[model samples]
Target: MHSRLVAVAATAAIALMAPTGALAQDATPMASPVGESLFAELGLPELTITVTDEGIEIDRSDIEAGRYLVTLNNESAEPEVFAGFVQIPEDRTLEDLSYADEVAAGTPIPEEGPAEEDFLWLYETYIAGGPSTVTEAARQVVVNLPAGSYGVWDEDPTSPRLAAALTVTGDPGVRVEGPEPEAAVTIIEEGEGGVGFSFRLDGEFVAGPQVVKVLNASDQPHFVEVSQYPEEITVEQVMATFMFDPSSGATPSPDMLDYERAIFAGWAGTQSPGATQWVIVDVAPGQVLVDCFIPDPLAEFTPHAFEGMLQLFEVAES
Candidate 1:
Protein backbone atom coordinates (compact mmCIF):
# COMPACT_ATOMS: atom_id res chain seq x y z
CA MET A 1 0.00 0.00 0.00
CA HIS A 2 2.89 2.42 0.76
CA SER A 3 4.38 1.65 -2.72
CA ARG A 4 1.04 2.47 -4.38
CA LEU A 5 0.80 5.81 -2.56
CA VAL A 6 4.33 6.75 -3.72
CA ALA A 7 3.40 6.17 -7.39
CA VAL A 8 0.30 8.40 -7.11
CA ALA A 9 2.26 11.21 -5.43
CA ALA A 10 4.92 11.08 -8.19
CA THR A 11 2.26 11.38 -10.91
CA ALA A 12 0.73 14.51 -9.25
CA ALA A 13 4.16 16.19 -8.98
CA ILE A 14 4.88 15.56 -12.71
CA ALA A 15 1.54 17.13 -13.71
CA LEU A 16 2.26 20.30 -11.69
CA MET A 17 5.74 20.65 -13.23
CA ALA A 18 4.32 20.39 -16.77
CA PRO A 19 2.03 23.45 -16.31
CA THR A 20 4.78 25.56 -14.70
CA GLY A 21 7.16 24.89 -17.62
CA ALA A 22 4.49 25.90 -20.16
CA LEU A 23 3.71 29.11 -18.28
CA ALA A 24 7.36 30.15 -18.29
CA GLN A 25 7.57 29.77 -22.08
CA ASP A 26 4.35 31.78 -22.61
CA ALA A 27 5.57 34.67 -20.42
CA THR A 28 8.69 35.34 -22.52
CA PRO A 29 8.50 38.41 -24.82
CA MET A 30 9.23 37.99 -28.51
CA ALA A 31 11.24 40.37 -30.76
CA SER A 32 10.61 40.97 -34.46
CA PRO A 33 13.24 41.57 -37.15
CA VAL A 34 10.80 43.07 -39.67
CA GLY A 35 9.30 45.63 -37.26
CA GLU A 36 9.63 49.35 -38.01
CA SER A 37 11.90 51.52 -35.89
CA LEU A 38 10.45 54.72 -34.39
CA PHE A 39 13.53 56.78 -35.29
CA ALA A 40 15.46 55.23 -38.10
CA GLU A 41 16.33 57.68 -40.93
CA LEU A 42 13.72 60.44 -40.67
CA GLY A 43 15.15 63.13 -38.39
CA LEU A 44 12.83 63.75 -35.42
CA PRO A 45 12.94 64.09 -31.63
CA GLU A 46 11.72 61.77 -28.81
CA LEU A 47 8.32 61.98 -26.99
CA THR A 48 6.38 61.04 -23.82
CA ILE A 49 2.78 59.79 -23.26
CA THR A 50 0.37 59.50 -20.30
CA VAL A 51 -3.31 59.18 -19.25
CA THR A 52 -5.20 62.35 -18.32
CA ASP A 53 -8.09 63.04 -15.95
CA GLU A 54 -10.28 64.11 -18.91
CA GLY A 55 -10.24 60.60 -20.41
CA ILE A 56 -8.88 61.71 -23.77
CA GLU A 57 -8.11 58.68 -25.92
CA ILE A 58 -6.19 57.93 -29.15
CA ASP A 59 -7.26 55.12 -31.49
CA ARG A 60 -4.60 52.54 -32.29
CA SER A 61 -6.01 49.65 -34.29
CA ASP A 62 -3.51 49.10 -37.11
CA ILE A 63 -0.56 47.09 -35.97
CA GLU A 64 0.69 43.63 -36.90
CA ALA A 65 0.71 40.87 -34.35
CA GLY A 66 4.07 42.05 -33.01
CA ARG A 67 5.91 44.77 -31.11
CA TYR A 68 6.06 48.53 -31.91
CA LEU A 69 7.68 51.74 -30.65
CA VAL A 70 6.02 55.21 -30.62
CA THR A 71 8.25 58.30 -30.40
CA LEU A 72 7.41 61.97 -29.71
CA ASN A 73 9.65 65.03 -29.91
CA ASN A 74 9.53 68.55 -28.51
CA GLU A 75 9.93 70.90 -31.50
CA SER A 76 9.56 74.17 -29.63
CA ALA A 77 11.87 75.75 -27.05
CA GLU A 78 9.35 75.58 -24.20
CA PRO A 79 8.48 72.63 -22.00
CA GLU A 80 5.07 71.00 -22.68
CA VAL A 81 2.93 68.62 -20.63
CA PHE A 82 0.86 65.91 -22.41
CA ALA A 83 -1.65 63.76 -20.48
CA GLY A 84 -3.63 61.01 -22.25
CA PHE A 85 -3.94 57.25 -22.71
CA VAL A 86 -3.71 55.26 -25.94
CA GLN A 87 -6.90 53.40 -26.91
CA ILE A 88 -6.66 49.89 -28.28
CA PRO A 89 -9.53 48.58 -30.40
CA GLU A 90 -11.31 45.48 -29.20
CA ASP A 91 -11.15 43.57 -32.49
CA ARG A 92 -7.36 43.63 -32.69
CA THR A 93 -4.99 41.16 -31.02
CA LEU A 94 -1.90 42.38 -29.08
CA GLU A 95 0.94 40.94 -27.04
CA ASP A 96 3.34 41.89 -24.26
CA LEU A 97 4.13 45.60 -24.79
CA SER A 98 5.33 48.51 -22.64
CA TYR A 99 5.71 52.36 -22.74
CA ALA A 100 8.75 54.48 -21.91
CA ASP A 101 9.71 58.20 -21.92
CA GLU A 102 13.24 57.99 -23.26
CA VAL A 103 14.68 56.06 -26.22
CA ALA A 104 18.42 55.57 -26.57
CA ALA A 105 20.21 58.89 -25.73
CA GLY A 106 17.11 61.16 -25.71
CA THR A 107 15.72 63.00 -22.65
CA PRO A 108 13.84 60.87 -20.10
CA ILE A 109 9.99 61.15 -20.23
CA PRO A 110 7.55 60.22 -17.43
CA GLU A 111 4.27 58.37 -17.90
CA GLU A 112 1.30 59.97 -16.05
CA GLY A 113 -1.10 57.31 -14.78
CA PRO A 114 -4.82 56.97 -15.78
CA ALA A 115 -6.62 60.32 -15.36
CA GLU A 116 -8.96 61.91 -17.95
CA GLU A 117 -9.90 65.37 -16.58
CA ASP A 118 -6.35 66.37 -15.85
CA PHE A 119 -5.23 65.42 -19.36
CA LEU A 120 -7.91 67.62 -20.96
CA TRP A 121 -6.91 70.59 -18.83
CA LEU A 122 -3.31 70.20 -19.94
CA TYR A 123 -4.28 70.00 -23.64
CA GLU A 124 -6.56 73.05 -23.48
CA THR A 125 -3.94 75.14 -21.74
CA TYR A 126 -1.32 74.30 -24.33
CA ILE A 127 -3.54 74.99 -27.40
CA ALA A 128 -4.77 78.37 -26.08
CA GLY A 129 -1.16 79.40 -25.45
CA GLY A 130 -0.35 79.17 -29.21
CA PRO A 131 2.84 78.11 -31.01
CA SER A 132 4.83 81.16 -29.85
CA THR A 133 4.78 79.95 -26.23
CA VAL A 134 3.71 76.30 -26.07
CA THR A 135 5.15 75.15 -29.38
CA GLU A 136 4.71 71.53 -30.58
CA ALA A 137 5.51 68.45 -28.53
CA ALA A 138 5.62 64.77 -29.64
CA ARG A 139 4.96 61.41 -27.97
CA GLN A 140 5.87 57.83 -28.79
CA VAL A 141 3.83 54.76 -27.72
CA VAL A 142 5.05 51.20 -28.25
CA VAL A 143 2.83 48.13 -28.54
CA ASN A 144 2.32 44.75 -30.22
CA LEU A 145 -0.80 44.36 -32.35
CA PRO A 146 -2.44 42.40 -35.16
CA ALA A 147 -2.95 43.90 -38.66
CA GLY A 148 -5.44 46.87 -39.14
CA SER A 149 -5.66 50.73 -39.28
CA TYR A 150 -4.87 52.64 -36.08
CA GLY A 151 -5.62 56.33 -35.42
CA VAL A 152 -3.03 58.14 -33.31
CA TRP A 153 -4.72 61.46 -32.43
CA ASP A 154 -8.50 61.77 -31.97
CA GLU A 155 -8.90 63.63 -28.69
CA ASP A 156 -8.23 67.20 -29.98
CA PRO A 157 -9.71 68.36 -33.27
CA THR A 158 -7.47 71.43 -33.28
CA SER A 159 -4.53 69.04 -33.43
CA PRO A 160 -5.24 67.12 -36.65
CA ARG A 161 -1.62 67.30 -37.73
CA LEU A 162 -0.77 65.15 -34.75
CA ALA A 163 -3.11 62.42 -35.94
CA ALA A 164 -1.19 59.51 -37.39
CA ALA A 165 -2.66 56.46 -39.16
CA LEU A 166 -0.80 53.23 -38.71
CA THR A 167 -1.63 50.48 -41.25
CA VAL A 168 -0.34 46.98 -40.80
CA THR A 169 -0.63 44.98 -44.04
CA GLY A 170 0.80 41.50 -43.86
CA ASP A 171 2.03 41.47 -47.45
CA PRO A 172 5.81 41.83 -47.57
CA GLY A 173 5.63 43.48 -51.01
CA VAL A 174 3.92 46.64 -49.70
CA ARG A 175 5.92 49.87 -49.73
CA VAL A 176 5.57 53.14 -47.85
CA GLU A 177 5.25 56.08 -50.24
CA GLY A 178 8.03 58.65 -49.88
CA PRO A 179 7.30 62.39 -49.95
CA GLU A 180 6.78 63.91 -53.43
CA PRO A 181 6.50 67.45 -54.87
CA GLU A 182 3.19 68.89 -56.00
CA ALA A 183 4.49 72.37 -56.92
CA ALA A 184 7.73 73.82 -58.25
CA VAL A 185 8.55 75.86 -55.12
CA THR A 186 6.90 77.36 -52.04
CA ILE A 187 7.57 80.67 -50.29
CA ILE A 188 8.95 79.87 -46.85
CA GLU A 189 8.42 83.44 -45.65
CA GLU A 190 5.96 86.11 -46.82
CA GLY A 191 5.53 89.92 -46.48
CA GLU A 192 8.48 92.21 -47.14
CA GLY A 193 11.85 90.49 -46.59
CA GLY A 194 10.22 87.46 -45.04
CA VAL A 195 10.73 84.83 -47.78
CA GLY A 196 8.83 85.03 -51.11
CA PHE A 197 9.42 82.38 -53.84
CA SER A 198 8.63 82.23 -57.58
CA PHE A 199 8.78 79.59 -60.39
CA ARG A 200 9.51 79.60 -64.18
CA LEU A 201 6.67 78.97 -66.65
CA ASP A 202 7.46 77.20 -69.98
CA GLY A 203 5.21 79.09 -72.49
CA GLU A 204 6.45 80.76 -75.66
CA PHE A 205 4.94 83.93 -77.20
CA VAL A 206 3.52 80.94 -79.22
CA ALA A 207 4.91 77.45 -78.41
CA GLY A 208 4.57 74.27 -76.25
CA PRO A 209 3.02 74.70 -72.77
CA GLN A 210 3.37 72.45 -69.75
CA VAL A 211 2.93 72.66 -65.96
CA VAL A 212 5.81 71.58 -63.74
CA LYS A 213 5.66 70.64 -60.08
CA VAL A 214 8.00 71.78 -57.28
CA LEU A 215 8.32 70.07 -53.94
CA ASN A 216 9.27 71.61 -50.58
CA ALA A 217 11.60 69.38 -48.59
CA SER A 218 12.23 71.70 -45.66
CA ASP A 219 10.30 71.91 -42.37
CA GLN A 220 9.05 75.52 -42.78
CA PRO A 221 6.04 76.84 -44.80
CA HIS A 222 6.56 78.10 -48.39
CA PHE A 223 4.83 79.53 -51.58
CA VAL A 224 5.58 80.44 -55.27
CA GLU A 225 5.01 83.52 -57.51
CA VAL A 226 5.69 84.07 -61.28
CA SER A 227 6.97 87.21 -63.06
CA GLN A 228 8.15 87.83 -66.64
CA TYR A 229 10.61 90.26 -68.25
CA PRO A 230 10.94 91.63 -71.86
CA GLU A 231 11.41 88.93 -74.51
CA GLU A 232 14.28 90.84 -76.21
CA ILE A 233 16.68 91.99 -73.46
CA THR A 234 20.40 91.61 -72.82
CA VAL A 235 21.89 89.65 -69.90
CA GLU A 236 23.28 92.91 -68.50
CA GLN A 237 19.78 94.38 -68.21
CA VAL A 238 18.43 91.32 -66.42
CA MET A 239 21.39 91.39 -64.00
CA ALA A 240 20.84 95.11 -63.26
CA THR A 241 17.20 94.60 -62.20
CA PHE A 242 17.80 91.43 -60.13
CA MET A 243 21.15 92.51 -58.57
CA PHE A 244 20.12 96.14 -58.06
CA ASP A 245 16.79 97.62 -56.97
CA PRO A 246 14.05 95.05 -57.83
CA SER A 247 11.38 97.39 -56.43
CA SER A 248 12.91 100.62 -57.69
CA GLY A 249 9.78 101.01 -59.89
CA ALA A 250 12.20 102.10 -62.60
CA THR A 251 10.58 101.54 -65.96
CA PRO A 252 12.53 100.39 -69.08
CA SER A 253 10.69 102.93 -71.30
CA PRO A 254 10.10 102.12 -75.03
CA ASP A 255 13.62 103.43 -75.80
CA MET A 256 15.55 102.49 -72.61
CA LEU A 257 14.32 98.86 -72.27
CA ASP A 258 11.65 96.42 -73.37
CA TYR A 259 8.36 96.07 -71.49
CA GLU A 260 8.25 93.27 -68.88
CA ARG A 261 5.16 92.03 -67.07
CA ALA A 262 4.14 89.64 -64.30
CA ILE A 263 2.03 87.17 -66.31
CA PHE A 264 1.04 84.71 -63.54
CA ALA A 265 1.37 85.29 -59.82
CA GLY A 266 0.28 82.37 -57.63
CA TRP A 267 1.60 81.20 -54.29
CA ALA A 268 1.58 77.78 -52.62
CA GLY A 269 0.58 79.65 -49.48
CA THR A 270 2.06 77.97 -46.42
CA GLN A 271 3.02 74.30 -46.22
CA SER A 272 4.10 72.42 -43.10
CA PRO A 273 7.31 70.43 -43.11
CA GLY A 274 7.24 67.27 -45.25
CA ALA A 275 4.19 68.55 -47.11
CA THR A 276 3.84 69.39 -50.88
CA GLN A 277 2.01 72.11 -52.86
CA TRP A 278 1.22 72.54 -56.59
CA VAL A 279 1.73 75.85 -58.54
CA ILE A 280 0.63 75.91 -62.21
CA VAL A 281 1.56 78.50 -64.89
CA ASP A 282 1.73 78.70 -68.72
CA VAL A 283 5.30 78.60 -70.03
CA ALA A 284 6.40 81.71 -71.95
CA PRO A 285 9.51 82.13 -74.10
CA GLY A 286 11.95 84.66 -72.65
CA GLN A 287 13.98 85.18 -69.50
CA VAL A 288 11.88 84.52 -66.41
CA LEU A 289 12.83 85.59 -62.92
CA VAL A 290 11.51 83.30 -60.16
CA ASP A 291 11.95 85.23 -56.92
CA CYS A 292 11.29 83.72 -53.52
CA PHE A 293 10.20 86.71 -51.46
CA ILE A 294 10.57 86.20 -47.73
CA PRO A 295 8.13 87.90 -45.42
CA ASP A 296 9.68 90.41 -42.99
CA PRO A 297 8.86 88.34 -39.89
CA LEU A 298 10.98 85.39 -41.08
CA ALA A 299 13.60 87.42 -42.97
CA GLU A 300 14.15 89.76 -40.02
CA PHE A 301 16.16 86.99 -38.32
CA THR A 302 17.69 85.18 -41.30
CA PRO A 303 19.65 85.99 -44.50
CA HIS A 304 17.85 83.80 -47.04
CA ALA A 305 18.54 85.88 -50.14
CA PHE A 306 22.34 86.07 -49.77
CA GLU A 307 22.34 82.35 -49.06
CA GLY A 308 20.91 81.63 -52.57
CA MET A 309 17.43 80.61 -51.40
CA LEU A 310 16.30 82.92 -54.22
CA GLN A 311 16.86 81.24 -57.61
CA LEU A 312 16.52 82.56 -61.21
CA PHE A 313 15.58 79.97 -63.90
CA GLU A 314 16.07 80.66 -67.63
CA VAL A 315 13.62 79.35 -70.30
CA ALA A 316 14.87 79.40 -73.87
CA GLU A 317 13.92 77.56 -77.16
CA SER A 318 12.81 73.94 -76.35
Candidate 2:
Protein backbone atom coordinates (compact mmCIF):
# COMPACT_ATOMS: atom_id res chain seq x y z
CA MET A 1 0.00 0.00 0.00
CA HIS A 2 1.23 3.52 0.65
CA SER A 3 4.17 1.96 2.52
CA ARG A 4 4.33 3.43 6.02
CA LEU A 5 5.72 6.86 6.91
CA VAL A 6 5.03 7.08 10.62
CA ALA A 7 5.99 4.85 13.56
CA VAL A 8 9.10 3.06 12.35
CA ALA A 9 9.77 0.79 15.35
CA ALA A 10 8.02 -2.54 14.68
CA THR A 11 7.61 -1.54 11.04
CA ALA A 12 11.38 -1.28 10.59
CA ALA A 13 11.70 -4.99 11.35
CA ILE A 14 9.02 -5.75 8.78
CA ALA A 15 10.40 -3.19 6.33
CA LEU A 16 13.92 -4.62 6.56
CA MET A 17 12.70 -8.17 5.89
CA ALA A 18 14.58 -9.62 2.90
CA PRO A 19 12.95 -11.73 0.24
CA THR A 20 13.84 -15.45 0.16
CA GLY A 21 14.71 -15.33 -3.56
CA ALA A 22 17.86 -13.26 -2.87
CA LEU A 23 19.15 -15.66 -0.22
CA ALA A 24 21.84 -17.96 -1.63
CA GLN A 25 21.38 -21.57 -0.66
CA ASP A 26 24.56 -22.75 1.09
CA ALA A 27 25.56 -25.56 3.41
CA THR A 28 27.91 -23.36 5.45
CA PRO A 29 27.05 -23.11 9.15
CA MET A 30 26.11 -19.79 10.73
CA ALA A 31 25.98 -18.22 14.21
CA SER A 32 24.91 -14.80 15.55
CA PRO A 33 27.38 -12.79 17.61
CA VAL A 34 26.34 -13.13 21.22
CA GLY A 35 26.26 -10.24 23.72
CA GLU A 36 28.06 -7.09 22.53
CA SER A 37 27.76 -3.34 23.05
CA LEU A 38 27.47 -2.44 19.35
CA PHE A 39 24.05 -0.95 19.97
CA ALA A 40 25.33 1.84 22.20
CA GLU A 41 24.72 4.28 19.36
CA LEU A 42 21.14 3.08 19.14
CA GLY A 43 20.66 3.19 22.94
CA LEU A 44 18.36 0.17 22.86
CA PRO A 45 18.74 -3.33 24.29
CA GLU A 46 21.10 -4.95 21.80
CA LEU A 47 20.89 -8.54 20.59
CA THR A 48 23.99 -9.01 18.43
CA ILE A 49 23.84 -11.99 16.04
CA THR A 50 26.56 -13.80 14.12
CA VAL A 51 25.94 -16.24 11.25
CA THR A 52 28.85 -18.18 9.86
CA ASP A 53 30.25 -21.73 9.51
CA GLU A 54 28.95 -22.61 12.97
CA GLY A 55 25.64 -23.33 14.67
CA ILE A 56 23.33 -20.50 15.82
CA GLU A 57 24.38 -18.75 19.04
CA ILE A 58 23.22 -15.71 21.01
CA ASP A 59 24.91 -13.52 23.59
CA ARG A 60 22.41 -14.75 26.21
CA SER A 61 19.53 -17.05 25.54
CA ASP A 62 17.12 -15.69 28.17
CA ILE A 63 15.57 -12.27 27.46
CA GLU A 64 12.75 -10.60 29.36
CA ALA A 65 9.72 -9.47 27.41
CA GLY A 66 10.35 -6.07 25.81
CA ARG A 67 11.64 -4.22 22.72
CA TYR A 68 15.12 -4.74 21.30
CA LEU A 69 17.36 -3.99 18.35
CA VAL A 70 18.34 -7.28 16.68
CA THR A 71 21.71 -6.69 14.95
CA LEU A 72 23.57 -9.10 12.70
CA ASN A 73 27.37 -9.38 12.61
CA ASN A 74 28.58 -11.40 9.62
CA GLU A 75 32.00 -13.09 9.93
CA SER A 76 31.77 -15.49 7.03
CA ALA A 77 34.44 -15.65 4.30
CA GLU A 78 31.89 -14.56 1.72
CA PRO A 79 29.16 -12.00 1.98
CA GLU A 80 26.34 -13.21 4.23
CA VAL A 81 22.87 -11.66 4.61
CA PHE A 82 19.90 -12.74 6.68
CA ALA A 83 16.37 -11.99 7.95
CA GLY A 84 14.59 -12.82 11.27
CA PHE A 85 10.99 -13.84 12.06
CA VAL A 86 9.39 -14.91 15.38
CA GLN A 87 6.38 -17.06 16.12
CA ILE A 88 4.49 -17.86 19.34
CA PRO A 89 3.53 -21.35 20.73
CA GLU A 90 6.70 -23.07 21.93
CA ASP A 91 5.72 -26.22 20.04
CA ARG A 92 5.88 -24.74 16.50
CA THR A 93 9.28 -25.84 15.14
CA LEU A 94 10.85 -25.26 11.73
CA GLU A 95 10.04 -28.82 10.66
CA ASP A 96 6.51 -28.29 11.88
CA LEU A 97 6.11 -24.99 9.99
CA SER A 98 3.38 -26.08 7.65
CA TYR A 99 1.28 -23.00 7.03
CA ALA A 100 1.33 -24.07 3.40
CA ASP A 101 0.50 -27.62 4.33
CA GLU A 102 -2.27 -26.23 6.49
CA VAL A 103 -3.42 -24.33 3.43
CA ALA A 104 -3.24 -27.53 1.42
CA ALA A 105 -4.83 -29.31 4.37
CA GLY A 106 -7.62 -26.70 4.43
CA THR A 107 -6.23 -24.68 7.45
CA PRO A 108 -5.21 -21.12 6.65
CA ILE A 109 -3.17 -18.35 8.34
CA PRO A 110 -6.31 -16.36 9.06
CA GLU A 111 -7.76 -19.22 11.10
CA GLU A 112 -4.51 -20.60 12.54
CA GLY A 113 -2.92 -17.18 13.12
CA PRO A 114 -1.50 -16.65 16.62
CA ALA A 115 -4.63 -16.21 18.70
CA GLU A 116 -2.89 -14.27 21.45
CA GLU A 117 -3.23 -10.59 20.56
CA ASP A 118 -1.68 -9.39 23.83
CA PHE A 119 1.83 -10.60 22.98
CA LEU A 120 4.30 -9.75 20.22
CA TRP A 121 3.26 -11.33 16.90
CA LEU A 122 4.96 -11.29 13.47
CA TYR A 123 4.18 -12.99 10.18
CA GLU A 124 5.68 -12.05 6.77
CA THR A 125 4.16 -13.51 3.61
CA TYR A 126 5.79 -11.20 1.03
CA ILE A 127 9.46 -10.30 1.18
CA ALA A 128 10.50 -6.78 2.04
CA GLY A 129 13.83 -4.82 1.81
CA GLY A 130 14.68 -6.76 -1.35
CA PRO A 131 17.42 -8.71 0.51
CA SER A 132 19.63 -7.58 3.34
CA THR A 133 23.42 -8.06 3.00
CA VAL A 134 25.40 -8.54 6.21
CA THR A 135 28.67 -7.17 4.75
CA GLU A 136 27.50 -3.58 4.86
CA ALA A 137 27.76 -2.54 8.48
CA ALA A 138 25.23 -4.37 10.70
CA ARG A 139 21.72 -5.34 9.60
CA GLN A 140 19.11 -4.76 12.29
CA VAL A 141 15.43 -5.02 13.20
CA VAL A 142 13.82 -3.27 16.20
CA VAL A 143 11.24 -5.56 17.75
CA ASN A 144 9.08 -5.95 20.89
CA LEU A 145 8.34 -9.25 22.52
CA PRO A 146 6.60 -11.04 25.37
CA ALA A 147 7.35 -13.91 27.75
CA GLY A 148 7.18 -17.08 25.68
CA SER A 149 9.12 -19.11 23.13
CA TYR A 150 10.28 -17.47 19.88
CA GLY A 151 11.43 -19.13 16.69
CA VAL A 152 13.97 -17.00 14.82
CA TRP A 153 13.36 -18.33 11.31
CA ASP A 154 16.34 -17.16 9.32
CA GLU A 155 14.74 -16.24 5.98
CA ASP A 156 16.78 -19.03 4.41
CA PRO A 157 16.46 -22.51 5.85
CA THR A 158 19.79 -23.66 4.43
CA SER A 159 21.87 -21.15 6.39
CA PRO A 160 23.36 -22.43 9.66
CA ARG A 161 21.37 -19.70 11.37
CA LEU A 162 18.13 -21.45 10.51
CA ALA A 163 15.54 -22.28 13.17
CA ALA A 164 17.25 -20.45 16.02
CA ALA A 165 15.37 -20.44 19.30
CA LEU A 166 15.02 -17.59 21.79
CA THR A 167 13.26 -17.79 25.15
CA VAL A 168 11.41 -14.90 26.76
CA THR A 169 10.60 -15.09 30.47
CA GLY A 170 8.58 -12.84 32.77
CA ASP A 171 5.39 -11.09 31.64
CA PRO A 172 4.11 -10.31 28.13
CA GLY A 173 5.59 -6.87 28.93
CA VAL A 174 5.09 -4.63 25.89
CA ARG A 175 3.03 -6.12 23.09
CA VAL A 176 4.62 -5.90 19.63
CA GLU A 177 2.61 -7.76 17.01
CA GLY A 178 4.39 -8.80 13.81
CA PRO A 179 3.43 -7.84 10.28
CA GLU A 180 0.54 -9.73 8.70
CA PRO A 181 -0.51 -9.43 5.04
CA GLU A 182 -4.17 -9.91 5.93
CA ALA A 183 -4.81 -6.40 4.53
CA ALA A 184 -3.61 -5.03 1.22
CA VAL A 185 -3.48 -1.79 -0.73
CA THR A 186 -2.52 -2.51 -4.32
CA ILE A 187 -0.42 0.41 -5.66
CA ILE A 188 -1.18 0.88 -9.34
CA GLU A 189 1.48 2.83 -11.20
CA GLU A 190 0.27 3.88 -14.64
CA GLY A 191 -2.94 2.22 -15.68
CA GLU A 192 -5.86 4.63 -15.31
CA GLY A 193 -3.81 7.36 -13.64
CA GLY A 194 -1.35 7.98 -16.45
CA VAL A 195 2.11 7.93 -14.76
CA GLY A 196 1.89 8.15 -10.93
CA PHE A 197 0.36 6.03 -8.13
CA SER A 198 -3.09 5.00 -6.96
CA PHE A 199 -4.34 2.88 -4.03
CA ARG A 200 -6.68 -0.06 -3.29
CA LEU A 201 -7.27 -0.30 0.46
CA ASP A 202 -8.39 -3.60 2.05
CA GLY A 203 -11.45 -2.20 3.78
CA GLU A 204 -12.85 0.87 5.53
CA PHE A 205 -10.88 0.96 8.79
CA VAL A 206 -10.29 -2.42 10.39
CA ALA A 207 -7.69 -1.77 13.07
CA GLY A 208 -4.83 -3.74 14.68
CA PRO A 209 -1.14 -4.16 13.79
CA GLN A 210 -1.58 -4.39 9.98
CA VAL A 211 0.74 -5.71 7.30
CA VAL A 212 0.00 -3.43 4.39
CA LYS A 213 0.75 -5.24 1.13
CA VAL A 214 2.24 -2.96 -1.52
CA LEU A 215 2.49 -4.02 -5.15
CA ASN A 216 4.24 -2.40 -8.06
CA ALA A 217 1.51 -2.35 -10.65
CA SER A 218 3.80 -0.26 -12.83
CA ASP A 219 6.39 -1.45 -15.29
CA GLN A 220 9.16 0.16 -13.23
CA PRO A 221 10.13 -0.56 -9.61
CA HIS A 222 8.80 1.97 -7.08
CA PHE A 223 8.48 2.76 -3.34
CA VAL A 224 5.99 4.67 -1.21
CA GLU A 225 6.23 6.68 2.04
CA VAL A 226 3.31 7.28 4.41
CA SER A 227 3.69 10.70 5.98
CA GLN A 228 1.58 13.35 7.69
CA TYR A 229 1.70 16.87 6.22
CA PRO A 230 0.82 19.96 8.18
CA GLU A 231 -2.49 21.59 7.33
CA GLU A 232 -0.60 24.51 5.79
CA ILE A 233 1.55 22.26 3.64
CA THR A 234 0.49 21.70 0.04
CA VAL A 235 1.52 19.05 -2.49
CA GLU A 236 3.25 21.69 -4.63
CA GLN A 237 5.36 22.72 -1.65
CA VAL A 238 6.46 19.15 -1.09
CA MET A 239 6.97 18.46 -4.80
CA ALA A 240 9.41 21.37 -5.02
CA THR A 241 11.84 19.49 -2.81
CA PHE A 242 12.32 16.90 -5.57
CA MET A 243 14.16 18.11 -8.71
CA PHE A 244 13.12 15.46 -11.23
CA ASP A 245 12.71 15.63 -15.01
CA PRO A 246 11.08 12.74 -16.91
CA SER A 247 12.56 13.71 -20.30
CA SER A 248 16.08 14.24 -18.95
CA GLY A 249 16.01 10.93 -17.02
CA ALA A 250 18.25 12.47 -14.39
CA THR A 251 18.13 10.86 -10.95
CA PRO A 252 16.86 13.50 -8.57
CA SER A 253 18.18 13.18 -5.02
CA PRO A 254 15.78 14.06 -2.21
CA ASP A 255 15.84 13.44 1.50
CA MET A 256 13.98 10.15 1.96
CA LEU A 257 13.73 10.53 5.75
CA ASP A 258 12.71 14.08 6.56
CA TYR A 259 11.53 13.63 10.15
CA GLU A 260 11.75 17.39 10.72
CA ARG A 261 9.57 18.36 7.74
CA ALA A 262 6.64 16.09 8.42
CA ILE A 263 5.50 13.19 10.60
CA PHE A 264 7.11 9.98 9.30
CA ALA A 265 4.45 7.29 9.44
CA GLY A 266 6.01 4.17 7.87
CA TRP A 267 7.34 2.96 4.51
CA ALA A 268 6.82 0.62 1.58
CA GLY A 269 10.31 -0.26 0.38
CA THR A 270 11.15 -0.25 -3.35
CA GLN A 271 9.25 -3.04 -5.10
CA SER A 272 9.78 -4.57 -8.54
CA PRO A 273 7.09 -5.16 -11.13
CA GLY A 274 4.56 -7.78 -9.99
CA ALA A 275 6.38 -7.80 -6.65
CA THR A 276 4.28 -7.34 -3.56
CA GLN A 277 5.49 -7.24 0.07
CA TRP A 278 3.88 -6.59 3.43
CA VAL A 279 5.10 -3.58 5.43
CA ILE A 280 4.19 -3.01 9.10
CA VAL A 281 2.95 0.38 10.30
CA ASP A 282 0.67 1.25 13.23
CA VAL A 283 -2.13 3.35 11.72
CA ALA A 284 -3.23 6.00 14.17
CA PRO A 285 -6.40 8.08 14.03
CA GLY A 286 -5.77 10.99 11.70
CA GLN A 287 -5.04 12.08 8.15
CA VAL A 288 -2.39 9.94 6.47
CA LEU A 289 -0.67 11.02 3.26
CA VAL A 290 1.06 8.61 0.86
CA ASP A 291 3.84 9.50 -1.62
CA CYS A 292 6.46 7.72 -3.63
CA PHE A 293 10.04 9.00 -3.45
CA ILE A 294 11.70 6.35 -5.66
CA PRO A 295 12.74 7.58 -9.09
CA ASP A 296 11.88 5.54 -12.15
CA PRO A 297 15.37 4.20 -12.72
CA LEU A 298 14.39 3.03 -16.19
CA ALA A 299 13.09 6.51 -16.99
CA GLU A 300 16.31 8.36 -16.18
CA PHE A 301 15.56 8.13 -12.45
CA THR A 302 12.63 10.51 -12.45
CA PRO A 303 10.74 10.78 -9.17
CA HIS A 304 7.42 8.93 -9.53
CA ALA A 305 5.51 11.35 -7.32
CA PHE A 306 6.19 14.21 -9.76
CA GLU A 307 4.54 12.06 -12.41
CA GLY A 308 1.44 11.78 -10.15
CA MET A 309 2.18 9.13 -7.49
CA LEU A 310 0.72 10.95 -4.49
CA GLN A 311 -2.54 10.91 -2.53
CA LEU A 312 -4.15 11.40 0.93
CA PHE A 313 -6.53 9.29 3.02
CA GLU A 314 -8.22 9.41 6.40
CA VAL A 315 -7.99 6.87 9.25
CA ALA A 316 -11.23 6.97 11.15
CA GLU A 317 -11.87 5.32 14.53
CA SER A 318 -12.52 1.61 14.10
TM-score of model number 2: 0.39
State how far residue 241 of model 1 sits from its true place (Å).
Answer: 4.8
Q: Clash number for model 1? A: 51
Window of ten residues with lowest summed lDDT in model 1: 126-135
Per-residue lDDT of candidate 2, residues 137-255 (tens digit): 22444444556666554442223334456787876544534432344344444432234545545544323334455655656544555555444344544453333333566554443
Q: Pick the candidate with the highest TM-score.
A: 2
Task: Give the TM-score of each candidate.
Answer: 0.30, 0.39
Q: After superposition, how far is residue 194 of candidate 2 from its true place, in Å?
A: 9.1
Error of 1 at 48 (Å): 39
lDDT (Cα, 0-100) at 9 in candidate 2: 17
